[model samples]
Target: MSWMSVDIGENRWLSVSYYCLRQGVSSGFRMRNWELQGCNDGLSWQMLCKHERDLSFGEQAHGVAGWAVENATAYRHFRILQTGKNSDAVHTGVLACAGIELYGALTLACCGRCAALVEIDGRALGSAAMLEGARAGEGVRGCSRALRRSGGGTRAAAEKALEAKGRREQREREVR
Candidate 1:
């Protein structure tokens, strides 16, 4: 049995709703029992979820080996512990994972009425500032049909918000 973990950095908390695991290209062994753990300080861990299915290479190759997290807990660190493998005696307990993907939404303010700006995959379809401007009784052109219909206020706030968001994303990318 073996275990592997990854740190998702600090300050930002992730609301992980689902996870995807892919088998390594050179490995034919499949994980039998696995547990996913989450932590805040990376010292104390909580069991997020566990699975005891056959994660065979053939099944994972078709992208059918993902599971939804029951509660969608927000955590800063995650660990994957493998306890068993579906292989012969010579290849027992060998763990080989090619890739793992976490899918979830980032906690962000949506101005109470701009839920439409967020897509089904937890991605914001538009800038937060534009949504906030629309909520603040300002007209944001081309942002949404509803906003365009209720046209009136100046575009100053929306523009400022978009600029700030752009700068923030740029800084975050640089940090990464």
Candidate 2:
């Protein structure tokens, strides 16, 4: 019985999720177990799920899908372990991975943890910075249909927000 382990991390820190798709029968062997591991400092590694059944199992697999980790202080990195049966068997593991996104509760004054423009009365609120947006108490950030004044007309704030977004989009394109 032979086993293979592949590291999913590089130099910089990253958090990624991967799903394993069985390509074909192990010719003369069979896969037994698999697991997921997480490492913060890289040196100290911890296994989240151990020897669990192949979660992302599929018949015909395309390929592995993965993404680099972001602002997560927790775990970051995972891989699949396919236990080979015999030395003569030809077993293949196709991995597909993507970044796991966790969402939290949203508040009326804020856009929660997600990156979205704050809006009220059809007005668009600007983000505080790259990773943050208008706080709950920082007036209105953006305008939505619900945030329009009692007259049910587009507010100046909303127009400003929209224009700002358009300019930002244009700037992004130019940068690219």
Number of the top lDDT candidate: 1
Candidate lDDT values, in order: 0.58, 0.35
Cα lDDT tens digits for candidate 1, 28-145 = 4666677878887988878877877654345443233788887466777888888666444477676666677776653332334333452212334344645465557664323332
TM-score of each: 0.55, 0.31
- Model 2 regions more than 4 Å off: 1-32, 52-56, 63-73, 81-88, 92-127, 131-176
- Sliding window of 10 residues with minimal summed lDDT for model 1: 144-153
Q: Candidate 2's C-alpha lDDT?
A: 0.35
Q: Show the colliding residue pairs in model 1.
A: none
lDDT of 2 by residue, 1-176 (tens): 23234442332233332233333333222233544455645456455444434323233333222222232333434444443232223433432222223121111223343344444444433343311322222344332221112211124444555556667779999999
Q: Quote the RMSD, in angstroms, for model 2.
A: 14.1
Residue 43, model 1: lDDT of: 83
Model 1 shows how many backbone clashes?
0
Error of 1 at 166 (Å): 11
